[model samples]
Target: MQKLSQTQFDFIIIGAGSAGATLAARLTENNQFSVCLIEAGGKDTSPFIHIPFGLAFLSRMTNLGWEYDTEPQSQLNDRSLFWPRGKVLGGSSSLNAMCYIRGVPEDYDRWNDMGAKGWDWQTVLPYFKKSEKQQHGESEMHGADGYLSVSDLRHTNPLSSTFVDAAEQIGLSKVTDFNGPDREGLGFYQVTQENGQRCSTAKGYLTPALTRSNLTLLTKALVEKIQIIDGVATGVKLQLDGQSIELTANKEVLLSAGAINSPQILMLSGVGPKEHLAENGIKVKVDLPGVGQNLQDHLDIIVQHHCKNRDSYSISLALIPRYIKNTFNYLFNRQGIFTSNVAEAGGFDKTQYAADIPDIQYHFLPAILLDHGRTTAFGYGFGVHVCGLYPKSRGEIRLRSNKPNTPAVIDPHYLEHLDDQKVMIDGVRRARKILAAASFDKYESWEVGPGPDAQTDEEILAFIRKNSETIYHPIGTCKMGDISDVMTVVDSQLKVKDIKGLRVVDASVMPSLVGGNTNAPTIMIAERCADLIKQEHK
Candidate 1:
């Protein structure tokens, strides 16, 4: 451990999240390269983190959550949105809804067209398949021997089934597998879990690699800045247990600190827009303007309905016995309400205004979720979340200060574009139709939010402006593209532009936002990145 500061390793991966965990594990598999994985947070041993249903309580666990908030959105009545990121070993993978969607083929093809060469559907599909251990068995579309677990939820509430049935009743066909032949239908989302527990990257990759002799895993290590000399990144300056240490990378320094931290680390190290760095008292190392630009995220609108049945989950004195039973059922049988990842069922769909693909996504929860689940309203209820997949609006992540602990300035600028608002309005209307179907008539009493009275487009628009929130998917701050693109921070190979021995390999490097969850794709990126690094040194 003492050699971390005195000797250089083959690679140093920052942020131990999805990409960092996968990249570190894959890089050390051959026992040829020594890898060091650094994480700002401690271990992923929190009892709430491993339980699938504990996500309900994770939003409030500040120790494990990097609870960030966006600047007041001008289009959303100047309301700041809550953004929860996992700060533990597995990163957001431990804090997410655990949906295992790889997005549609066109999503990657769009990346190819956007100047991220060799990242088209066909080229990237293999990586997705390579990293998955699907419970449904192996096929051309899925892998069975991979490390990450992909399985169907052990149990689902009846309301989730109703949501699917209602979607089918409205001409939206039912799909058994969203990651299969088509992603344009309704179904339950397969989660990243094994048995009844979560299979976060920390559990999937880092745990196994911990026993490897060549791998070094550091926890509670805050990386202050990259130690860049001339044009090459030599190492990183990080603080661990009140001690300042510098870890050198013999081969390369991989920055996988996610969308916000990745760009912030870059800028703090003097590798961002020259003027912005100068304004923040950071000397310019490389004037890369796209270091923290082009941020993309999904702004969700939730429609809630009061429940007519008492059996459904709710906060009530009468449910004390039920809660106790469910707890024992989960502890002993490993199956029950506690095993449910609140977002039990969800799917992707296309509106009439879609651009040749599914442009809308729905996450159906059997329980009410308000204020990012921060404010709980008593009584039985359910919610359906609707989010426009691809937003035209872009934002930025800037250094709030030079301090490593200082949070980055996140401005997602949601709904700033007129088209984003229009699509959301359409999404809300379609969500209402799904709820109105006969399938939900048995349990649904009435719409509690934006109620039945708010029917006009102006009314819907106004409702959206006041209530839209983030769905926790953020990407593309340090975008990857060809050299010709001025806004590209990293090249097609993920190398930091004009900088040697440095690379950005995380969601931040995504040229555009994928049509689905970012965790699976982020793991795939690290898998491929491991190959790239290995080939370069081979």
Candidate 2:
């Protein structure tokens, strides 16, 4: 144990990612309120973070990520899947695909129905609008004057457009916007980009507010535990550059360390299940049984093919001249191949398991992506990533030990439920159908993943178990619900049920997983939390 020196602020926010960055910026708007935003990783200075197409290389960079892995899931052929979470200032938003999706209205409405009051579509829509600066201008569904910039892709591979055409050929309607009223369709995805660069929360919210006298940003600071005295979270104890430091928050200690870290922090602070805490040699405090339970994530399987033409993005000697031209094009105009977010086009569709809304999602990449883009395939190719939107399977994050630096045991239990398995099979079949459409005749060649041999339902299930990986959307660890629900870790206000001056203001508080990407919705949660905290303090 190291000796600590104390520092104080009006609010101390853990993790300077999407939610924390937004909260730190919004809370410090009133000059009187001082905010300290602490991040485990260094600054978002990586060129890969800002460059839209750099995500392919970004996935392989271990320095910018938490570098977590699951506990060998049995359903997935006993494989331990890698979970890369952003450790940088903007967090995962800086490392994500930059797709600006806010799921369907029913997603939030379901949250309200699940006991999260004031979180329905109508109540939450304003916060979504408040956080977005839509390129198409303001409308009933969007806002034009917000911090995060959302724009249509300036550059896309020809194969991506062909994918949209192919989906249309397979009977899926062409949709201009997935965020609008009509959600079920295939089309190009809008990205969180401005001109060409990614509009991560660090760029959109934190960077502009850095010069503020009231805001303090700390990087490479790992929070060990919350300083909870008499069941009230007074501050946090963290390790900064091999030295221990205690930060006190006069108003509140906001935990926006994301889904994994948020719950892990609570458990480290002795706020988790009593039995589990005792096993890890931790003294019990709140004994919240739901601290690390109810973990859910989107598991994706790729349907890939070798392209007959050179239109797809790939590493080949034949494309050297094109690469050189694209390099200069990006350097001068911020356009060309470098401007493309690999998953350029995608769509939403309902499987047989779905009732009304889309239960399966597709991300069409004009390249051969393997191992989250960590493994490179040589030849020209394209792939469609498919994921079951609503997974019936549930997993949990548990402590490896009482130590904070030691990575937590993450078990997503992917494809544990029969319904999830069935949904994934349907999603893969839909993707294959679109790829086989007449529109792809010019570029399509032989199938790469789950080859032609995988034809039957049993074979498809086996292929899914062998090939599935996370699409990076994880939520519901510190679930929010009404008082009647025992699993509710936080209430509608995001405050810890029995703790004072503490709140979990990130994706963890979602009652259930949203229909699409979690980044946009996570920002909205923080935007709403800032207002909730302001009202109480005012």
Candidate 3:
């Protein structure tokens, strides 16, 4: 391969998703280094990109999402699952439900125990604070001024508030903040919004960073592979505009390309398991088999129920006029139904016994979501999303072939661990208990999904195994630990242990899946990684 361009950048960050954009922005602040960020997706300019409630619609919108699905799972009735990842500048943070969750403190403490230095609760807290700006004002646990927007929803639907009040009726406490010092009980969620609009990572970090001359962002460019010379990452091979091009990295090459693509890129570039590469007819750059192991994600089994009144959100021709009004208000006044993030409020709670934090989390929807896409028939219903916070399940990602655009073998291997199955079972049972309680009976007319028929532990397990789907919080592919830890792909500083000048700084590096939404924690990881890079240069 010829050296197409002689220019070299101090840093080249692949996949301008959540972590890539963030790191590129912070690292270029010094103006002493040039940064190049490459993203395969187009710009984040869609109207739904800023609307909170529009996420339900965006998941089906193929233009903005990377509609990746997992291989059939043995545990889930052999069902193939859907995985919607944002392919744009902000990544999933641009298309997600906008829920702001920092996970639990114990999540980071476990990282410290696994030899990931400076990743404990105390060390990571500042990074979280630095990445976000809490609307409720700063406290010891929260920050006020930061790149990411964190604010309470403006037009909170009445039913969501009623749901919270009903929880108190059922003797469940209404904890203010799940990301606070203590994590427990049900509460209204603090969303990643700014004045009734979605404030994505691109809007927060990359957009502003574009003003600086040191930062160069290239969209609609796919990173096909990393270029390694003498076991050192030197550049990248990418495809854009119907042609392939090569670019060099002067200092370091960072792979913040999420879990699925990051590991796939490493393997495609000959840096994965030696045997797998040999079988696939690719020369092995390194024999790091752990490049695509330890995949984990939350599985949510929705329980829908018919409502007694007209509070449900069912957009029909009859309601199209109302939706039009709501959309106008969002564009002009920045309020109304468009501002309401339907997956508004929920929390974590222990299933078996008393504990400081909750082992399970809930996503309370104000409208009926029968399936992935809106069908010709519609009804009035609300859903309770039950998920296991700390799942013991583990999966792996392997290269399907050497092709860069080829989808990898993503095996969530959900419920492979018996304990994970138990937790999910308990989660379903607990959701039923909540719906059956007096709080739910006050407004709920009928049990729709996994209804009264799906009873008993066996029935619940069967229902969960058949109907459950991922919450899109996959992590732990390129993990970090001591060098001797054979399963870990990165060291404490996030560098690939066997390959020099190459590192992966994304959710893929998370050794364990964070107990809550992966968005906030993913941004925090970028802040922490930026510090590591800065200290090394100093």
lDDT of 3 by residue, 1-538 (tens): 2222334798999988889989988999879988988898999998888887777688768888778889999999999899888898799889888899988888899999988877999999999999988887888998888889898888876667766776666668787887877757778899999988888889888888999988878888889999999989999999878788888998899999999999999988998889998988888889998989989998888887886566768755567787889888988999999888888878777787325567888998878775454333366667789888778888999988888888889999988888877887787777666666666665756887787898887888898888888888999999988789888899989999778899999999999877889999999999999999988876
Candidate 2 lDDT by residue in tens digits, 1-538: 2222338899999999999999999998889898989999999988999888899899898899999999999999999999989999899999999988999999999999999999999999999999999999999999998899999999988899998887668888999998999978899999999989999999999988898989888899999999999989999999987888888999899999988999999999999888999999998989889998999999999998996699998999999999999989999999989988899999999888899889999999888888888898788889999999999899999999999999999999998899999999988888899889998888648897889999999999999999899999999999999866788999999999899999999999988889999999999999999999999999
How close to the true structure is residue 469 of candidate 2, measured as C-alpha lDDT? 93
Candidate 3 global lDDT:
0.85
lDDT at residue 131 of model 2 (Cα atoms): 96
Error of 1 at 164 (Å): 1.0
Better-scoring candidate (lDDT), 1 or 2: 2
**Clash list (residue pairs), candidate 1:** none
Model 1 regions lying over 4 Å from their true place: 1-7
Q: All candidates' TM-scores?
A: 0.98, 0.98, 0.96
- Where's the lowest-lDDT run of ten residues in candidate 1? 1-10
Backbone N/Cα/C clashes per model: 0, 0, 1
Question: Of the pair 1 and 3, which is ahead by TM-score?
Answer: 1
Q: Given candidate 1, what's the lDDT at residue 310?
A: 74
